[model samples]
Target: MLRDLAGAEWPRRAGLAALAAALGAENIRWVGGAVRDGLLGVAAHDVDCATTLRPEDVIAACKRAGLRTAPTGIEHGTVTVILKDGPVEVTTLRRDVATDGRRATIAFASDWSEDAARRDFTINALYAHPETLAIADYFGGLDDLREGRVRFIGDARQRIAEDHLRILRYYRFQTRFGAALDEAAETACADLAHTLKGLSRERIAAELLALLALPDPHPTIARMRERGVLGVILPEACPAQVAALARLIAAESAQGFAPDPIRRLAALLPPSPDVAETVAARLRLSKAQRTRLVNAAERTAHDSANAKALAYRLTPPLAIDRLLLEGADARGLDRWAVPQFPLKGGAIVARGVTAGPSVARLLQAVEARWVGEGFPQGERIEALLAEELAKRPQP
Candidate 1:
């Protein structure tokens, strides 16, 4: 009985109305996450539309309406309609002509059911007319969504064989929406777990992080471990690390810190910087991501360091990561702006220290003392500089 997209604010947006009028409302229907999340009464962030119009025609129609359009994925039959509210992805209806687990060969179609059949999950196949807001459930998606079930649209094995990343996507959806795992879907994912090796590491990393980013993913992660799916993409994560993730989640809750996928990822690895670096490289994490993962894995005695000192030594965010992982207090640094050291290298050189390596060493010593002494300023900085200068040999 899913009749209308009641809570979905996107359809009411003026830009969407303009786009619909320009393209003829009958040709387009809101599809995918927008429809699914709208049914669940959750606010949808991205609005995707499936249309009978071809890509070039979509571009032409938008231009005729004086609306900006981008060929964001024109080859894949998608056109981006840039509205003032946000960019809406308008994709022509497509059916997969062929799939090889890595990529798909698609063919444009006029049938909505054909397009829905090509999707991975039943809940994702729901569509809604833009004007009337009537929902179209092609594969019992509304029922499955109401029942809190995450099931593939067709045969789970056949759907997963088309895209190995769906295995990870299944677990991610199950973690977020399912009250109980669909036994058949679970079995299919487990049986085809080895196929994940054929997919790109970047794809694997993206899915893994998305799963970790869930509100409470440790239980699902433990499930992933039991199926041996986690080992294929992330061999560094051991069974023991699942418990560590649970602990990290609890710490994050207790400390009122937001759930961080990268930090949670750090919890799933052995507390070794070398292992973190290896995992980061294997997953193709960005440079900043690699650094954060490695820093979180460092086996430092975070409990011993005061909040300010830790923040000064290893940055506020990284320090917060270490403190939370160790189950220590991180509230002291909350909204506390880290003060800069008052002394500079030039200031040290002005104190008769040579402008070479000695000045650098003197600056480091003073900075350390300043950090150790709680980042004192004004006259206290002058005193620290004098003490460091006294230790240095007179030129």
Candidate 2:
């Protein structure tokens, strides 16, 4: 499975050469998500190296090789080796000393299996040789990967007890790569969903964003709802809106729309500004994210006479978001083609109108007439503007 990954890239080689020379080649191996992604033919974003050497040993090797090093997590036996492209994280093998469902105290260990066992899931426990790419799987992650199963490393309850964040991670991995969750894992997550409140808002928000970004997350969301996890994370979550999300996904697919987490979140929430505001505040969303969600909800509520009116009143993104939420296609967004009002303040001034509120009022009146008349162009627009101004009582 790792044959294609054997020919290490320069970054991989550089990291390995620096470390293998200082700590024996037998002590270092590529570990964590990189191994799993490599076997799945997914481009590993960050290359992580695990070693039997202590954190200081890893740092010394990086310094001896003339590479920059940082103690990113030295207390947990991890160091960052800065390479040309990016820093690769290297962690010494460690066994858990204690866990409190949020953090784990660790003690460095020489046994690779102990480190592997301490991990959360079987697939994430797999390791690879930095030079030869030989897989070291002590947990049958290879079989799970082949079968598209997401299983915990050992006891599901024990893994969840180590870190409640894993509850979200389990669903995320299932949505991203795996087909389904093991029954025991599902039961454990459902029973422990309440613990998610103990997690930081940032962590919970990040996981939710990842889950919502999946190509099609309606089923995953439904599963989350069934497991009681969704309500725990988002008290205002509307599982009933999964149907709306399905329409959104279909519309996006047909029209080549990029997956948008904020927009999808709007669809998942009750289409009310109050609900949007509450979710935004609960998730601690950025100002921009909050504004977009709220605007989409507000804009989608108005009964636009047509797509043109909708686009002209709001923005294309807002209109499209609203359309999808209503189970309607955003077909004309790319071709919104809403011509300008064809009347500006200067034009109103040229009409012998004062530059005060009257000028603004007259211009707005003419623009409304033009829009009401279906955005007539050229001479007709000029004629219509003249008629509207003449009908206004002299001031």
lDDT of each: 0.89, 0.81
lDDT for 341 in candidate 2 is: 80
Q: Could you give me the TM-score of model 2 versus the true structure?
A: 0.89
lDDT, model 1, position 72: 95
lDDT string for model 1 (1-395, tens) is: 34358656767899989999999989999999888887787788899999999999999999999999999999999999999999999999999999999999999999999999999999999888888888888899888998999999989999999999999999999998898789999999999999999999999999999999999999999988889988888888898888889998999998788899999999999899999999999999999999999999984664446877888778788888888887778886768798977778888767666688888888888888888888888999999888877876655
In angstroms, the error of model 2 at 279 is 1.0
Candidate 2 lDDT over residue span 267-300, tens digit each: 7877789889988888899998998899877854
Global Cα lDDT for candidate 1 = 0.89
In candidate 2, residue 85 scores what lDDT? 65
Candidate 1 residue spans exceeding 4 A from truth = 1-4, 302-304, 332-334, 345-358, 386-395
Instruction: Show where candidate 2 strays beyond 4 Å.
Output: 1-4, 7-25, 299-305, 332-342, 369-384
